[model samples]
Target: MQDALIVLVHGAGIGAVFALIGMSFNVVFNSSGILNFAQGNMLVLGGLFAFLVLPSSPGIGPWFVFLPASALLMAALLAVQGYLTLLPLRSSVEQHSWLITTLAASVIIGAVLLIFQGTAQQTVRSPFPSFWFLGTRVPAPYALSLLLALVWFGLLRWFHTRALTGLAISAIAQDLDAARAAGIRVHRLQILAFAISGLIVGSAGFVAAPVIAIANDSGVSYVLHGFVAAVIGGLGSDLGALVGGLLVGMISMYAAYTYGGEFQDAVSLALLVAVLMGRPEGLFGRPAARRV
Candidate 1:
């Protein structure tokens, strides 16, 4: 029973991180129709920013101070990258230029980190102190990650329903041509999406620092994991991201416990393959319809 509880708590924390990554992917895709393969690296950038901004002793001050700072920095940096990636290709004939451009941006970020920070892994201490729960030791960071995920989800839902800019984003996602014809600024909204995505994912990385170690090349693997979660949840569905993240997180934790840590990736791959083969549109994704 204790083992089961442990897995549950552990899986919930992991799910929170995956959910954040998946939602960030969904935001960029919905706004710009671009997958922004650099999503994971953006999280890495957030951690690095927090590392640089905070004093060596992080728990000494109000941790909330660093949160917005990292988030805003991430928002600015990623918005610029999004602009460069999208603006020039506004009239390009090639439909998939984003594939190369986003990947290139990711590579550049990784290279920059390597050149300056070296290949060593950096740790970010959690601001919250540890606590005991259900007769188990639960790190404050893990619990905080879960709380933040819920809050972020609610905030996003409200933004989509009540905010004018959010409505514009939804309109664009539904039909870009119609939205533009209606006098909506498509490019600007897309850039805003990128900025918002950065803020969310950057904060996720920052809060998750205590649990996940940061390294220059860690972004690629995270991208894959997050991508899998997004696919499972349906690429553009925010609700799907939440459910899918939790599902994937639990699956990963269980697999690691039952078989071994080595089987974690293998299990995830198999699940992804099964989903693609059976329901390419994903569990929540709507099947694409075209005029005959």
Candidate 2:
């Protein structure tokens, strides 16, 4: 029972990170109809930033400063990337240019990280102390990651429902052409969405860095699992991302416990395949309608 509880906590913590990445994907996809593949790399970059800027032993004050600074920096960078990615095409959905553009951006970011950070896995000592939970020594970062996920989810929900700009962003997601016709600045909103995505994943990466291995190549795995979570939850649903992330996290953890660590990815892949076969639209995703 204690073992199970430990797995649960660890799974939820790591799952929260995946959920943040999934939410980032949804944000970009919704606003621009383009999946900013660079998002995963951006998360890695966030951790790298934390590694570079943060002291070996940081206190709560350092984290408070790090969070907003990381968000702003990521937002600016992603917004610029979004602009470049969207500049060549009139309609993002109609043209497939983003596939290449975003991927190229991702590659460039990864390359840069590799050049500077190298292949060694980096880990920072957590400023917060570990606590015992039901005979398990639980790390503080795990609980903090889960808390951040829930807080971000609530904040996003409020933004979508209450904020005018967020409502406009949602309008663009629903019908780009209609939103443009309604005088909404679609392109601007798309850029904002990318920035918002950066804010989400960037802060997440920083907070969760203590638990996860930070390395240049780690982006690929993070993105892959995050994409799986997003697909499982439905592409545009934030709530779905949360649920999917937790589900994926728990399943993978359980698989590791039962079959061994190597089987974690395999189990996640199997779950993804099952979801695709049984419900392609995802648990919370509505079927998209097309006018022929």
Candidate 3:
């Protein structure tokens, strides 16, 4: 029973991280109709920023002072990156340039971090302390991570449903021509998507740094797993991304717990294959309708 509970907590924590990444992916994809492969690196960059700004060891003083500062800096930098990505393709028919641009941006960011942080693994202590709950131990970082995920989810849901800007972005995602005809600033919204992506992933990294060691090469792994979660949840569905992330996290955790850490990737791949084969649109994804 204790083991089961532990698994559940750990899975939830990891799932939240993936869900955060997945949602960031969806935000940009929905708004711009482009997949930013650099989404994952935003998380890495956030961690790196936090590492340099925040204290190497966790404490309330350092966290309170540096967390927001680091996050803002990361967001601004990534927003600039967002602009660079769309600059070249704004008037061109080559819509796929985002693939190269975002990837290149990610490489550049990684290289920059590598130059400063080196190849060493970096770890930080959780800002919050662990506590016991119902006879099981809960790590503070995991709890904080899960809380952040839930909060981000609720806030995003509200934003998309209630905010005018959010609705405009959604409209653009549904039909760029219609949104433009309605006088929606499609270009501005795309930039907003990039900024929001940075915000979400950057905050997530700030919280998740304690749990996962940050390294220069961690971005690609995050991209792969987060992409799988987003794909599994359906491309543009936030709730789908959440569910997919939870499933991926649980599967990976279970495999590690049962077989060994070495088999976690294998299990995740197998599950992705099974899901793709069974439901191409994802578990909660809606099917497209065509009108002749």
Q: Which number leads on lDDT?
A: 2
All candidates: TM-score: 0.94, 0.97, 0.93
**Pick by TM-score: which candidate is best?**
2
Clashes of 2: 0
- Kindly report which residue stretches of model 1 are placed more than 4 angstroms away from their true locations once superposed: 91-94
Which parts of model 3 have CA positions greater than 4 angstroms off?
90-94, 133-136, 289-292
Count backbone clashes in candidate 3: 0
Candidate closer to the true structure by lDDT (higher is better), 1 or 3:
1
Residues 1-292 of candidate 3 have per-residue lDDT tens digits of 7776677678877888888888888888888877888877788777766776666566788876766666676678767877888887753223788888989987987787789889897877777887887566777767776787788778888888899999998897777778889999888888888888877888888878877658878888888788888889988888888888888888898889889999988887888888889998877777766457
- Candidate 2 vs candidate 3, lDDT winner: 2
Q: How far is candidate 3 from the true structure (C-alpha RMSD, Å)?
A: 2.1
Q: What's the lDDT for candidate 1?
A: 0.82
RMSD of 2: 1.1
lDDT of 1 by residue, 150-177 (tens): 8878888888879999999998888887
Rank by TM-score (best first): 2, 1, 3
How do the residues 90-163 of candidate 2 rate in per-residue lDDT, one tens digit apiece?
99989999999988988998888789878898777668898988777878878888888898889888888899
